[model samples]
Target chain A: MSQKQEPRRKPGRPKAGTDQPDARDAILDQAEFCFAAAGFAGASLRDIATRAGVNQALLRYYFGSKQDLFDAVFRRRGGMISGRRHVLLDRALAEAEPTVETLVRAYLRPQWEMKQSGPGGAAFIALQARVHAEPEAHALDLRREVYDPSLKRYIDALSGLLPAIPRDLVATRMAFLVGAYLFMLNDLGRLADLSEGQIREIPPDDMLEQLVRFLSAGLLAPAI
Target chain B: MSQKQEPRRKPGRPKAGTDQPDARDAILDQAEFCFAAAGFAGASLRDIATRAGVNQALLRYYFGSKQDLFDAVFRRRGGMISGRRHVLLDRALAEAEPTVETLVRAYLRPQWEMKQSGPGGAAFIALQARVHAEPEAHALDLRREVYDPSLKRYIDALSGLLPAIPRDLVATRMAFLVGAYLFMLNDLGRLADLSEGQIREIPPDDMLEQLVRFLSAGLLAPAI
Candidate 1:
């Protein structure tokens, strides 16, 4: 219940300065793995502590319970996530008349260049996938806190291209894009085999252009 | 473990007809709901049986165990699912050339028009959403058995139109479309309040035309 935010905390070690992923980092790592596997209720502090090579006493010393550890994990990473979504859209939209390709690339590039391709990409993707399916309050808090600011820019850019479509329909189409983005980011392993690695080589610009065209057409299609 | 498929029984109901949803049907419904809410191990047969207004014995009688019941639910719905996807796509593609709009409609129409629409569509959606997130043997079985056939058709059609881009890229775009379809069908219950009723009101032909034009432009767009 009593959780503290360590937002301004230094990136490296604590006061004593220990090495490794860090006790805090290690705990989050195992929690991500556990939550991804056993889910929220099914995972235990002992399991996490065991996985992290730490004692249960140290876990409680830092974060009161399993959920406190979870809260810390969400709060710390949530900004990076929203930031990824925000930067992509904002950078693309900054153009005088950002083409659909620029816009699509803007949306996807941040994820790929950062989390999706980096060391922790798979775990982050798994966490995102887990949140979508389960929707913990911690994750929802971050989603509500950050989604609009990050995504509204994309909606505006898309609206600019399709003036004929009603504002609400534009919003609906945006919603469609968001859903698809979640699938692409989360289904890495399945998609790895599914698409045969074209996602890897194709330039983000071209991929994005095709995405916008496909989505714009599909969303505008009549509901049969 | 002796889970028989009711091999000797006649189709529909017995001549001495039963009024209930049937033991097997009840178990499936309850299992789907419970699985949707809590997932596999998180859900219990006693809970499912209680939810179905039947005894636990009935569930065991029809499906042997929880795993058996889970497999049976997916197994029963498997054909209807894959068949609907193929039929929808086939109808949409039968024309000399197909537009993205028609393709989108055909892709989505089957899930919308099922006879079982009155029940918990959201629950089923949520369940599938959860299963797809983690993906074990159960999720894989359904994906291959229920999804791959139609997915191939969609990919083949898209590949024909955009031959320059890699075939895998086309499939990823298709995956994006599927993501949107799944989200709309499952969530997005607030569409009416959002003034998104236009999605439901437009004629199917007009809708398809708009979608195809929008998709075609972007898919073929060399602007990137």
Candidate 2:
């Protein structure tokens, strides 16, 4: 191997500010698909490299390792989604009285907007769903750092809104809300077979409306 | 290789019967874990064989191919769960004036029972969630055959109960219900991290009760 191709660099510091913006985006895009489809353990750097049309060395030059690449792919999209959610939640909390419906909309509306953010947005949603559903904490460190804070805020906001509901119940409902939203938005198309043609016919906004409606009801429901 | 070890078999058919029940069960159990963790494309027979404490050839000898083995693992638990769901729904239908609570309980109670059906049961729930969330039709054939029938039954029953709710809305709610239930039942512990000890305290029965209560509300909530 030539020294030019495989330049030894410090670990954890990928060559920053790429001259070729598309190259970096291309690598991340392919990595997103791979990691979404196969997962962190299942996805291989070689496959991602080949798909991105970059050599393995170049791939590592851009991203230190597979784990780092996975983190990069996660962060590229996670920052956008979580950042938007934080803003929405902040706006809702500033209101004098934030109802569960408003909070639910704040938490869920970004997912609908993400559906319009093109393939990268959808891929990120799928990747998030996979990582969220993962049993092992493969992506736990990043998740805790990047996303959990926003979730905690929402959980706290909802807990205060529904004092009649137990605090634990708020957290549980939040988990359920996220679980249902991610599943519905990410793999909701798979339900086409189940719905014959009905699920496919509903517009994205309508789908989000129904999801918000369902989640709000569950959140506001009285304990038996 | 000796005839006993390297038995030439057809691609689709493994040996008719297994002399060792434990080995087969062990193989299915390990396969369930690997497939759930890594997915079909990501999981390898070698890893499964190693985990099962069996040789790769012996593993193939029993299950034909990795796909066949995946199918076996899926069917082993899926059939039981779907079958029990069918029976429960049947019993609920037989009851006089089966309320939404009755139907919801019938649909969800089995999942709690499944939690006690050993590791295989838990693994199956995770596997089902993985397969359900998967967008690709990797194992769509089996899923369609095993799951859609019971889901249709539940949807129809729910539609009847909520005559005011649109049929398509019932389908959407069913999707959300399954998504939430599967996530809650399968990886509910993952939330303990998010809840920071609050979610950890809820007893399993209370958890199920909360789930049932939440789902019942969502199912019965008036469409806006």
Candidate 3:
């Protein structure tokens, strides 16, 4: 929770020559931490500003309001993850025949990689899981805007592979896949405790393989 | 969020014989709602008291502290769900050979029935999902205490069925099954949106069937 090390400026004012990009990034990062720790309704602008070593006025200037700031935090990482998903999907489709496993891997790997990338990425993973629990007013638009199109692409690709399964069932299973992956991403030591340290350390690649295999089987299950 | 009406009393005082059990149940219900909407760090005792139509002092008198109240909320429904799971498991094991589907259904149906039971049950489902996203200090003990024993029973049963899969891998897939079921439990309109009205309404029984099928396939997948 340490603030960035730099010379302090007036609390409400951003100097014209200051690195505005750094300030904005810092605000989003701290906002993600706060929003993830306490949910959207619980996180305060003052707390986020203080954690970022900036002032509330600067946050307002950069992001307009708390809601706007939340949307920004989501868009910053949600957009990036969605973008990566599309790229992965493109390469998978271009490289070889897209089996359910290939499509599942393509959809899941980007988020897995992002979660392992750094603290900020991990915070976003937690925040994304929290988003599903949020009230519709707060979460619906953000979800539709940030994730729907990319998710639709994956769902369609999955449908293409499982032609016997209805598209709606495919969509339903896609939602299940998301739940499984998000839980694994923010497991918070459940696996270690559950396994009693027997499987304490799973390499990221192997973990991803397990997820893909489980989900691929699920997505390919016969329609009932 | 309307408070239940019987008769208004002094804000800070509980009547000597005014249905103490009812008051305690009311407090647990509203507390579940608040904690589900706001994370443990974000939910306030004052808000919960107000929502329950009691005062903060009564909450303190009954539950000791906010953490204690949270644990109570979890234990109330969590204990019930786990209890139901054990019953189902017993019946499954005695009535027939415990196939993966039967074990999966035994583990999953209790929570599904609870979610479909009433608003109080649904609130607890949301609260349970939010529990995983909570910090370790808030979530760890409750999860281990309320859920681990029943979950371990199911994991062992599944391992007994799938002798080829390692026990730790079985544990990991159990975690995945939890995530999938929880997400499906609190889908929050994602399925309708994802399906674009094509599958707007699914019967609860059918939804549970789909979940059981998906997870059975996942849990029974060949070890990677």
Give the per-prediction TM-score of chain B. 0.72, 0.84, 0.88
Q: After superposition, which runs of candidate 1 have C-alpha atoms over 4 Å from their true positions? A: A1-21, A57-61, A64-68, A87-97, A117-119, A135-142, A160-162, A192-224, B1-21, B57-61, B93-98, B135-138, B157-166, B190-224
Tens-place lDDT per residue, model 1, B1-224, is: 67866445344535555667476677788898788777776788899988887777778877797787876766555556668878877777788887755676676665565423656554566666666666455566666666776777777776776678667776767677666656555545433333323444434334334333434443443323
TM-score of every prediction relative to native: 0.75, 0.88, 0.91
Which lDDT tens digits does candidate 1 get at residues A1-224?
56877466344335654455478778887877677666666678899888997767778888887777766665566667668877667666676887655665566555555454654555666666566565334555555554556666676776687677666666666666666766766654465445543445555445555565666555444332
How many pairs of residues collide in each model?
5, 0, 0
Q: Give the clashing pairs for model 1.
A: A217-B211, A217-B215, A221-B207, A222-B207, B101-B212
Instruction: Report the C-alpha lDDT of model 3 over A1-224, residue by residue, as the tens digit.
Output: 68877776645556778666688889999999999877787689999999997778889999998889999999999999999999999998897677889889888888988888998998899899888765556686788899899999988887888889988888888989888988888883667777754656666678889989998899888998
Query: What TM-score, to 2 decimal places, does chain A of model 3 have?
Result: 0.89
Error of 3 at B141 (Å): 2.3
Please give, as one word, the docking class of candidate 1: acceptable
Best by DockQ: 3
Q: Per-candidate interface C-alpha RMSD? A: 4.4, 1.8, 1.7
Clashing pairs in 3: none
For candidate 3, lDDT tens digit of each residue in B78-129? Answer: 9999999999999999975668999898898899889888988888898898
Question: Which predicted model would earn the best lDDT?
Answer: 3
Q: Write the per-residue lDDT of candidate 2 for residues B48-73, one digit (tens) a residue.
A: 98898777888888889877898899
Off by over 4 Å in 3: A1-21, A197-201, B1-21
lDDT of each: 0.63, 0.81, 0.85
